[model samples]
Target: MLYRLDISNILFLDIETVPEKEAFNALSEEKQLLWEQKTKYARKDEFTPAEFYERAGIWAEFGKIVCISVGYLTYTGENRNFRVTTFYGEEDKLLKEFKQLLETHFNQPKHLLCGHNAKEFDFPYIARRMVIHGIQLPYKLDLFGKKPWEIPHLDTMELWKFGDYKHYTSLKLMANVLGIPSPKDDMEGSMVRQVYYEEGDIDRIITYCELDVVTTAQVFLRLRGDALLPHDAIKKV
Candidate 1:
Protein backbone atom coordinates (compact mmCIF):
# COMPACT_ATOMS: atom_id res chain seq x y z
CA MET A 1 0.00 0.00 0.00
CA LEU A 2 1.21 3.51 -0.70
CA TYR A 3 1.89 5.96 2.10
CA ARG A 4 -1.38 7.67 3.07
CA LEU A 5 -0.35 10.75 1.11
CA ASP A 6 -1.93 11.76 -2.18
CA ILE A 7 0.66 13.31 -4.50
CA SER A 8 -1.77 16.09 -5.38
CA ASN A 9 -2.34 17.31 -1.84
CA ILE A 10 0.96 18.23 -0.30
CA LEU A 11 2.82 21.48 0.14
CA PHE A 12 6.60 21.44 -0.28
CA LEU A 13 7.95 23.87 2.31
CA ASP A 14 11.37 25.19 3.29
CA ILE A 15 12.60 28.01 5.53
CA GLU A 16 15.78 30.05 5.90
CA THR A 17 16.47 30.25 9.64
CA VAL A 18 18.06 33.22 11.43
CA PRO A 19 19.11 33.80 15.01
CA GLU A 20 16.84 35.79 17.35
CA LYS A 21 19.46 37.46 19.53
CA GLU A 22 21.22 40.70 18.68
CA ALA A 23 24.36 39.86 20.61
CA PHE A 24 24.43 36.79 18.41
CA ASN A 25 25.35 39.10 15.54
CA ALA A 26 26.41 42.54 16.77
CA LEU A 27 29.35 41.36 18.84
CA SER A 28 32.79 42.66 17.87
CA GLU A 29 35.30 40.14 16.60
CA GLU A 30 37.09 40.03 19.96
CA LYS A 31 33.80 39.74 21.78
CA GLN A 32 32.64 37.17 19.21
CA LEU A 33 35.80 35.25 20.05
CA LEU A 34 34.89 35.31 23.69
CA TRP A 35 31.27 34.37 22.91
CA GLU A 36 32.40 31.54 20.65
CA GLN A 37 34.73 30.23 23.34
CA LYS A 38 31.76 29.91 25.67
CA THR A 39 29.30 28.74 22.99
CA LYS A 40 28.49 25.02 22.95
CA TYR A 41 28.07 24.37 19.21
CA ALA A 42 31.09 26.32 17.95
CA ARG A 43 34.51 24.84 17.28
CA LYS A 44 37.74 25.97 15.65
CA ASP A 45 37.13 24.14 12.39
CA GLU A 46 33.36 24.24 12.25
CA PHE A 47 30.75 26.97 11.98
CA THR A 48 29.69 27.07 15.57
CA PRO A 49 26.25 28.40 16.36
CA ALA A 50 28.03 31.67 17.16
CA GLU A 51 30.02 31.38 13.99
CA PHE A 52 26.80 30.55 12.18
CA TYR A 53 25.23 33.73 13.48
CA GLU A 54 28.22 35.97 12.82
CA ARG A 55 29.20 34.76 9.38
CA ALA A 56 25.97 33.26 8.05
CA GLY A 57 22.66 35.07 7.41
CA ILE A 58 20.86 32.31 9.27
CA TRP A 59 20.06 35.00 11.79
CA ALA A 60 20.17 38.19 9.81
CA GLU A 61 18.26 41.39 10.74
CA PHE A 62 17.93 41.13 14.49
CA GLY A 63 17.48 37.46 13.56
CA LYS A 64 14.14 38.03 11.86
CA ILE A 65 12.90 35.71 9.10
CA VAL A 66 14.21 36.53 5.64
CA CYS A 67 11.88 34.48 3.47
CA ILE A 68 9.86 31.28 3.10
CA SER A 69 8.84 29.99 -0.34
CA VAL A 70 6.01 27.42 -0.34
CA GLY A 71 5.56 25.51 -3.56
CA TYR A 72 2.40 23.65 -4.58
CA LEU A 73 3.05 20.63 -6.78
CA THR A 74 1.07 17.62 -7.81
CA TYR A 75 0.62 15.21 -10.74
CA THR A 76 -1.79 16.84 -13.13
CA GLY A 77 -2.47 15.81 -16.72
CA GLU A 78 0.69 13.68 -16.67
CA ASN A 79 2.69 16.79 -15.81
CA ARG A 80 3.74 18.58 -12.63
CA ASN A 81 3.15 22.28 -12.14
CA PHE A 82 5.04 23.86 -9.29
CA ARG A 83 3.72 27.16 -7.98
CA VAL A 84 5.66 28.82 -5.16
CA THR A 85 3.29 31.06 -3.24
CA THR A 86 4.84 33.90 -1.30
CA PHE A 87 4.40 32.98 2.35
CA TYR A 88 7.34 35.21 3.04
CA GLY A 89 9.13 37.98 1.20
CA GLU A 90 11.56 40.80 1.94
CA GLU A 91 8.80 42.01 4.28
CA ASP A 92 6.98 40.22 7.16
CA LYS A 93 3.78 40.05 5.13
CA LEU A 94 4.69 36.58 3.93
CA LEU A 95 4.36 35.17 7.42
CA LYS A 96 0.70 36.18 7.63
CA GLU A 97 0.19 35.00 4.07
CA PHE A 98 1.82 31.70 4.92
CA LYS A 99 -0.41 31.27 7.94
CA GLN A 100 -3.44 31.87 5.79
CA LEU A 101 -2.23 29.36 3.22
CA LEU A 102 -1.70 26.70 5.84
CA GLU A 103 -5.08 27.33 7.41
CA THR A 104 -7.06 27.76 4.20
CA HIS A 105 -5.33 26.06 1.28
CA PHE A 106 -4.25 22.96 3.13
CA ASN A 107 -6.75 20.51 4.64
CA GLN A 108 -5.76 20.48 8.24
CA PRO A 109 -4.79 17.11 9.87
CA LYS A 110 -5.00 15.48 6.46
CA HIS A 111 -2.59 17.02 3.95
CA LEU A 112 0.91 15.58 4.12
CA LEU A 113 3.88 17.84 4.79
CA CYS A 114 6.95 17.20 2.64
CA GLY A 115 10.45 18.55 3.13
CA HIS A 116 14.13 17.55 3.12
CA ASN A 117 15.01 17.89 6.82
CA ALA A 118 11.62 19.31 7.68
CA LYS A 119 10.81 16.83 10.41
CA GLU A 120 13.93 17.88 12.25
CA PHE A 121 14.62 21.43 11.15
CA ASP A 122 12.18 23.22 8.89
CA PHE A 123 8.89 22.27 10.55
CA PRO A 124 9.87 23.11 14.08
CA TYR A 125 11.61 26.32 13.09
CA ILE A 126 8.54 27.49 11.21
CA ALA A 127 6.02 26.32 13.79
CA ARG A 128 7.86 27.77 16.77
CA ARG A 129 8.16 31.13 15.13
CA MET A 130 4.56 31.02 14.02
CA VAL A 131 3.46 30.52 17.60
CA ILE A 132 5.82 33.31 18.62
CA HIS A 133 3.97 35.50 16.16
CA GLY A 134 0.64 34.30 17.65
CA ILE A 135 -0.43 32.14 14.72
CA GLN A 136 -1.87 28.67 15.18
CA LEU A 137 0.29 25.64 14.48
CA PRO A 138 -0.56 23.74 11.33
CA TYR A 139 -2.29 20.45 12.10
CA LYS A 140 0.20 18.16 10.38
CA LEU A 141 2.82 19.45 12.78
CA ASP A 142 0.54 18.88 15.74
CA LEU A 143 1.50 15.21 15.58
CA PHE A 144 4.12 15.72 18.23
CA GLY A 145 2.78 13.08 20.65
CA LYS A 146 1.79 10.52 18.04
CA LYS A 147 3.93 7.55 17.09
CA PRO A 148 6.79 8.32 14.70
CA TRP A 149 5.27 6.52 11.75
CA GLU A 150 1.76 7.56 12.70
CA ILE A 151 2.22 11.12 11.56
CA PRO A 152 2.41 11.93 7.85
CA HIS A 153 6.06 12.87 7.56
CA LEU A 154 7.82 12.46 4.22
CA ASP A 155 11.24 13.69 5.22
CA THR A 156 13.66 13.07 2.33
CA MET A 157 16.68 13.14 4.61
CA GLU A 158 15.27 10.52 6.98
CA LEU A 159 14.03 8.35 4.13
CA TRP A 160 17.52 8.24 2.61
CA LYS A 161 19.51 8.04 5.82
CA PHE A 162 17.81 4.79 6.74
CA GLY A 163 19.36 5.00 10.19
CA ASP A 164 22.70 6.80 9.53
CA TYR A 165 24.49 9.13 11.99
CA LYS A 166 26.24 11.40 9.54
CA HIS A 167 26.27 15.16 10.15
CA TYR A 168 24.28 15.83 6.99
CA THR A 169 24.26 14.37 3.54
CA SER A 170 24.07 17.28 1.15
CA LEU A 171 20.77 17.40 -0.78
CA LYS A 172 22.85 17.37 -3.96
CA LEU A 173 24.37 14.04 -2.99
CA MET A 174 20.99 12.58 -2.10
CA ALA A 175 19.53 13.73 -5.42
CA ASN A 176 22.40 12.21 -7.45
CA VAL A 177 22.33 8.92 -5.50
CA LEU A 178 18.60 8.68 -5.96
CA GLY A 179 18.84 9.50 -9.70
CA ILE A 180 17.05 12.83 -9.18
CA PRO A 181 18.30 16.13 -10.57
CA SER A 182 20.39 18.19 -8.17
CA PRO A 183 19.20 21.68 -9.06
CA LYS A 184 20.72 22.71 -5.76
CA ASP A 185 24.11 22.58 -7.46
CA ASP A 186 23.71 26.24 -8.42
CA MET A 187 23.74 27.78 -4.92
CA GLU A 188 25.29 25.79 -2.08
CA GLY A 189 23.78 25.78 1.43
CA SER A 190 26.78 27.53 2.92
CA MET A 191 26.30 30.25 0.36
CA VAL A 192 22.56 30.44 1.12
CA ARG A 193 23.39 31.26 4.70
CA GLN A 194 26.33 33.48 3.74
CA VAL A 195 24.75 35.48 0.90
CA TYR A 196 21.76 36.37 3.05
CA TYR A 197 24.00 38.12 5.56
CA GLU A 198 26.76 39.71 3.49
CA GLU A 199 24.65 40.98 0.61
CA GLY A 200 21.29 41.25 2.45
CA ASP A 201 19.65 40.07 -0.73
CA ILE A 202 16.41 38.23 0.12
CA ASP A 203 15.92 37.23 -3.50
CA ARG A 204 19.01 35.03 -3.66
CA ILE A 205 18.05 33.42 -0.37
CA ILE A 206 14.51 32.79 -1.63
CA THR A 207 15.85 31.31 -4.85
CA TYR A 208 18.22 29.10 -2.91
CA CYS A 209 15.43 27.87 -0.65
CA GLU A 210 13.17 27.27 -3.66
CA LEU A 211 15.84 25.26 -5.47
CA ASP A 212 16.32 23.08 -2.44
CA VAL A 213 12.54 22.67 -2.21
CA VAL A 214 12.34 21.55 -5.83
CA THR A 215 15.11 19.05 -5.23
CA THR A 216 13.32 17.89 -2.12
CA ALA A 217 9.95 17.55 -3.85
CA GLN A 218 11.63 15.62 -6.63
CA VAL A 219 13.11 13.29 -4.08
CA PHE A 220 9.66 12.75 -2.56
CA LEU A 221 8.09 11.91 -5.91
CA ARG A 222 10.83 9.39 -6.62
CA LEU A 223 10.34 7.84 -3.23
CA ARG A 224 6.62 7.47 -3.89
CA GLY A 225 6.92 5.99 -7.37
CA ASP A 226 9.94 4.59 -9.14
CA ALA A 227 8.53 5.40 -12.57
CA LEU A 228 8.13 9.14 -12.00
CA LEU A 229 10.09 10.91 -14.71
CA PRO A 230 12.56 13.58 -13.75
CA HIS A 231 11.11 17.00 -14.52
CA ASP A 232 12.83 19.59 -16.69
CA ALA A 233 15.41 20.50 -14.07
CA ILE A 234 17.65 22.50 -16.35
CA LYS A 235 19.94 25.12 -14.79
CA LYS A 236 17.68 28.12 -14.30
CA VAL A 237 18.06 31.23 -12.25
Candidate 2:
Protein backbone atom coordinates (compact mmCIF):
# COMPACT_ATOMS: atom_id res chain seq x y z
CA MET A 1 0.00 0.00 0.00
CA LEU A 2 1.10 3.57 -0.66
CA TYR A 3 0.26 6.78 1.14
CA ARG A 4 0.22 10.26 -0.32
CA LEU A 5 0.21 13.59 1.51
CA ASP A 6 -2.92 15.59 0.97
CA ILE A 7 -3.27 19.11 -0.43
CA SER A 8 -4.88 20.17 2.87
CA ASN A 9 -1.35 20.39 4.16
CA ILE A 10 -0.82 23.11 1.63
CA LEU A 11 -1.99 26.66 2.19
CA PHE A 12 -2.79 28.71 -0.87
CA LEU A 13 -2.81 32.48 -0.26
CA ASP A 14 -2.43 35.81 -1.99
CA ILE A 15 -1.49 39.20 -0.43
CA GLU A 16 -2.50 42.75 -1.18
CA THR A 17 -0.39 45.75 -0.15
CA VAL A 18 -0.66 49.49 0.36
CA PRO A 19 1.67 52.21 1.65
CA GLU A 20 2.42 52.37 5.35
CA LYS A 21 1.30 55.51 7.13
CA GLU A 22 4.42 55.84 9.25
CA ALA A 23 6.71 55.07 6.35
CA PHE A 24 4.88 57.58 4.22
CA ASN A 25 5.34 60.26 6.89
CA ALA A 26 9.01 59.43 7.35
CA LEU A 27 9.90 59.96 3.70
CA SER A 28 12.63 62.60 3.69
CA GLU A 29 12.36 65.56 1.34
CA GLU A 30 15.43 64.46 -0.62
CA LYS A 31 14.25 60.86 -0.76
CA GLN A 32 10.85 62.11 -1.81
CA LEU A 33 12.34 63.97 -4.77
CA LEU A 34 14.35 60.89 -5.78
CA TRP A 35 11.26 58.71 -5.45
CA GLU A 36 9.30 61.11 -7.63
CA GLN A 37 12.03 60.92 -10.23
CA LYS A 38 11.91 57.15 -10.01
CA THR A 39 8.17 56.43 -9.96
CA LYS A 40 7.48 59.41 -12.24
CA TYR A 41 3.77 58.86 -12.47
CA ALA A 42 3.45 58.51 -8.68
CA ARG A 43 2.44 61.69 -6.85
CA LYS A 44 4.39 60.72 -3.78
CA ASP A 45 5.22 64.35 -3.12
CA GLU A 46 1.59 65.36 -3.12
CA PHE A 47 0.28 62.49 -1.05
CA THR A 48 -0.23 63.07 2.64
CA PRO A 49 0.10 60.02 4.86
CA ALA A 50 -3.66 59.61 4.81
CA GLU A 51 -3.81 60.00 1.07
CA PHE A 52 -1.04 57.48 0.57
CA TYR A 53 -2.86 54.93 2.69
CA GLU A 54 -6.03 55.61 0.77
CA ARG A 55 -4.36 55.02 -2.60
CA ALA A 56 -2.00 52.14 -1.96
CA GLY A 57 -3.50 49.08 -3.61
CA ILE A 58 -1.08 46.23 -3.16
CA TRP A 59 1.87 47.69 -1.26
CA ALA A 60 1.11 49.86 1.73
CA GLU A 61 -2.55 49.62 2.67
CA PHE A 62 -4.25 46.41 1.58
CA GLY A 63 -0.63 45.54 0.98
CA LYS A 64 -0.53 45.31 4.77
CA ILE A 65 -2.94 42.37 4.37
CA VAL A 66 -5.98 43.58 6.31
CA CYS A 67 -7.42 40.36 4.96
CA ILE A 68 -5.81 36.96 4.44
CA SER A 69 -7.80 34.17 2.82
CA VAL A 70 -6.62 30.60 3.19
CA GLY A 71 -7.85 27.55 1.29
CA TYR A 72 -6.91 23.88 1.47
CA LEU A 73 -7.89 20.85 -0.56
CA THR A 74 -6.87 17.26 -0.08
CA TYR A 75 -7.75 13.80 -1.39
CA THR A 76 -9.43 11.38 0.97
CA GLY A 77 -9.89 7.90 -0.39
CA GLU A 78 -11.27 8.76 -3.82
CA ASN A 79 -12.63 12.23 -3.11
CA ARG A 80 -11.23 15.73 -2.76
CA ASN A 81 -12.79 18.52 -0.72
CA PHE A 82 -11.71 21.98 0.41
CA ARG A 83 -12.03 24.27 3.43
CA VAL A 84 -11.50 27.99 3.64
CA THR A 85 -10.26 30.14 6.50
CA THR A 86 -11.08 33.74 5.91
CA PHE A 87 -9.34 36.17 8.25
CA TYR A 88 -9.74 39.92 8.57
CA GLY A 89 -7.61 41.41 11.28
CA GLU A 90 -4.31 43.07 12.00
CA GLU A 91 -1.51 41.75 9.79
CA ASP A 92 0.62 40.56 12.70
CA LYS A 93 -2.17 38.57 14.34
CA LEU A 94 -3.17 37.06 11.04
CA LEU A 95 0.38 36.05 10.18
CA LYS A 96 0.66 34.28 13.52
CA GLU A 97 -2.49 32.28 12.87
CA PHE A 98 -1.40 31.44 9.35
CA LYS A 99 2.02 30.22 10.46
CA GLN A 100 0.49 28.23 13.28
CA LEU A 101 -1.79 26.42 10.89
CA LEU A 102 1.15 25.42 8.70
CA GLU A 103 3.28 24.39 11.69
CA THR A 104 0.55 22.23 13.17
CA HIS A 105 -0.61 20.31 10.09
CA PHE A 106 2.74 20.17 8.30
CA ASN A 107 5.48 18.85 10.52
CA GLN A 108 7.51 17.62 7.54
CA PRO A 109 8.69 19.01 4.24
CA LYS A 110 6.90 16.19 2.40
CA HIS A 111 3.77 18.36 2.61
CA LEU A 112 4.39 20.97 -0.05
CA LEU A 113 2.87 24.45 0.09
CA CYS A 114 1.32 25.68 -3.14
CA GLY A 115 0.30 29.12 -4.37
CA HIS A 116 0.10 30.82 -7.76
CA ASN A 117 2.91 33.44 -7.59
CA ALA A 118 4.19 32.35 -4.23
CA LYS A 119 7.89 32.14 -4.94
CA GLU A 120 8.26 35.64 -6.30
CA PHE A 121 5.65 37.43 -4.22
CA ASP A 122 3.15 35.69 -1.97
CA PHE A 123 5.57 33.47 -0.05
CA PRO A 124 8.18 36.15 0.47
CA TYR A 125 5.63 38.75 1.45
CA ILE A 126 4.08 36.45 4.04
CA ALA A 127 7.43 35.26 5.41
CA ARG A 128 8.87 38.72 5.82
CA ARG A 129 5.71 40.01 7.42
CA MET A 130 5.72 37.05 9.76
CA VAL A 131 9.24 37.92 10.79
CA ILE A 132 8.20 41.50 11.40
CA HIS A 133 5.45 40.21 13.67
CA GLY A 134 8.09 38.15 15.55
CA ILE A 135 6.56 34.85 14.50
CA GLN A 136 8.69 31.87 13.53
CA LEU A 137 8.07 30.83 9.97
CA PRO A 138 7.46 27.31 8.74
CA TYR A 139 9.86 25.59 6.33
CA LYS A 140 7.37 25.98 3.52
CA LEU A 141 7.48 29.78 3.76
CA ASP A 142 11.19 30.04 4.61
CA LEU A 143 12.90 30.52 1.22
CA PHE A 144 14.55 33.89 1.83
CA GLY A 145 18.05 32.44 2.17
CA LYS A 146 17.76 29.95 -0.69
CA LYS A 147 19.63 30.75 -3.85
CA PRO A 148 17.58 32.00 -6.74
CA TRP A 149 16.47 29.45 -9.39
CA GLU A 150 17.43 26.66 -6.96
CA ILE A 151 14.70 26.89 -4.36
CA PRO A 152 11.77 24.50 -4.44
CA HIS A 153 9.19 26.78 -5.98
CA LEU A 154 6.25 25.87 -8.17
CA ASP A 155 4.74 29.01 -9.65
CA THR A 156 1.72 28.27 -11.85
CA MET A 157 2.62 31.09 -14.23
CA GLU A 158 6.16 29.78 -14.71
CA LEU A 159 5.11 26.15 -14.97
CA TRP A 160 2.55 27.12 -17.56
CA LYS A 161 3.75 27.47 -21.15
CA PHE A 162 7.21 26.39 -19.97
CA GLY A 163 7.88 29.92 -18.68
CA ASP A 164 8.19 32.45 -21.47
CA TYR A 165 9.90 34.84 -19.03
CA LYS A 166 7.75 37.75 -20.01
CA HIS A 167 7.75 41.10 -18.22
CA TYR A 168 4.34 40.62 -16.63
CA THR A 169 1.37 38.26 -16.60
CA SER A 170 -1.49 38.78 -14.17
CA LEU A 171 -3.36 35.76 -12.83
CA LYS A 172 -6.47 36.99 -14.63
CA LEU A 173 -4.91 36.69 -18.09
CA MET A 174 -3.22 33.44 -17.28
CA ALA A 175 -6.53 31.84 -16.26
CA ASN A 176 -8.17 33.20 -19.38
CA VAL A 177 -5.46 31.80 -21.63
CA LEU A 178 -5.75 28.42 -19.96
CA GLY A 179 -9.54 28.43 -20.51
CA ILE A 180 -10.18 28.65 -16.78
CA PRO A 181 -12.75 31.08 -15.39
CA SER A 182 -10.93 33.97 -13.75
CA PRO A 183 -12.18 35.75 -10.62
CA LYS A 184 -10.80 39.14 -11.57
CA ASP A 185 -14.25 40.42 -12.38
CA ASP A 186 -15.31 39.79 -8.78
CA MET A 187 -13.29 42.89 -7.90
CA GLU A 188 -9.99 44.07 -9.31
CA GLY A 189 -6.84 43.88 -7.19
CA SER A 190 -6.65 47.65 -7.54
CA MET A 191 -9.88 48.05 -5.58
CA VAL A 192 -8.80 45.89 -2.65
CA ARG A 193 -7.08 48.60 -0.64
CA GLN A 194 -10.00 50.97 -1.04
CA VAL A 195 -12.62 48.43 -0.09
CA TYR A 196 -10.65 47.39 2.96
CA TYR A 197 -10.10 50.97 4.01
CA GLU A 198 -13.57 52.28 3.35
CA GLU A 199 -15.98 49.43 3.88
CA GLY A 200 -13.83 47.09 5.97
CA ASP A 201 -15.20 44.32 3.83
CA ILE A 202 -13.03 41.26 3.38
CA ASP A 203 -15.60 39.05 1.69
CA ARG A 204 -14.47 40.25 -1.72
CA ILE A 205 -10.85 39.61 -0.89
CA ILE A 206 -11.64 36.16 0.48
CA THR A 207 -13.59 35.30 -2.64
CA TYR A 208 -10.73 36.52 -4.78
CA CYS A 209 -8.05 34.66 -2.83
CA GLU A 210 -9.92 31.36 -2.60
CA LEU A 211 -10.73 31.45 -6.30
CA ASP A 212 -7.07 31.89 -7.17
CA VAL A 213 -6.19 28.97 -4.93
CA VAL A 214 -8.70 26.75 -6.71
CA THR A 215 -7.49 27.84 -10.14
CA THR A 216 -3.89 27.28 -9.12
CA ALA A 217 -4.83 23.79 -7.97
CA GLN A 218 -6.30 23.20 -11.40
CA VAL A 219 -3.13 24.36 -13.11
CA PHE A 220 -1.03 22.18 -10.83
CA LEU A 221 -3.19 19.12 -11.32
CA ARG A 222 -3.32 19.67 -15.06
CA LEU A 223 0.45 20.03 -15.21
CA ARG A 224 0.71 16.73 -13.36
CA GLY A 225 -1.43 15.22 -16.15
CA ASP A 226 -4.42 14.77 -13.86
CA ALA A 227 -2.72 12.25 -11.63
CA LEU A 228 -5.45 13.22 -9.17
CA LEU A 229 -9.06 12.59 -10.13
CA PRO A 230 -10.14 15.29 -12.57
CA HIS A 231 -13.49 15.91 -10.90
CA ASP A 232 -11.99 15.75 -7.46
CA ALA A 233 -9.34 18.33 -8.26
CA ILE A 234 -11.30 20.68 -10.49
CA LYS A 235 -14.08 21.87 -8.19
CA LYS A 236 -14.83 25.60 -8.55
CA VAL A 237 -14.54 27.60 -5.35
- Judging by TM-score against the true structure, name the best candidate: 1
Superposed on all Cα atoms, the candidates' RMSDs to the truth, in angstroms, are 4.5, 5.1
CA deviation > 4 Å runs, candidate 2 = 1-9, 22-57, 60-63, 144-152, 161-163, 183-185, 227-237
For model 2 the TM-score comes to 0.73
Q: In model 2, where is the ten-residue run with the lowest total lDDT?
A: 54-63
Q: Candidate 1 has what TM-score?
A: 0.75
For 1-237, candidate 1 gives per-residue lDDT tens digits of 345566667778788765444346565677566555555454456666554555433423234566776766655576666666444553346666776777787865567778887877777666666666766666666666888767866778877777886857767787888887556345666565456655677677777887777777777777777454345522232
Clash total of candidate 1: 5
Candidate 2 has an lDDT of 0.61
Q: Residue by residue across 114-201, what tens digits does model 2's lDDT show?
A: 6677767777777767776677877777766778643544566666546467646667777677666554446776776656656667
Model 1 alpha-carbon drift over 4 Å, by segment: 1-4, 20-38, 44-52, 55-63, 90-92, 144-150, 163-168, 227-237
TM-scores for all candidates: the values are 0.75, 0.73
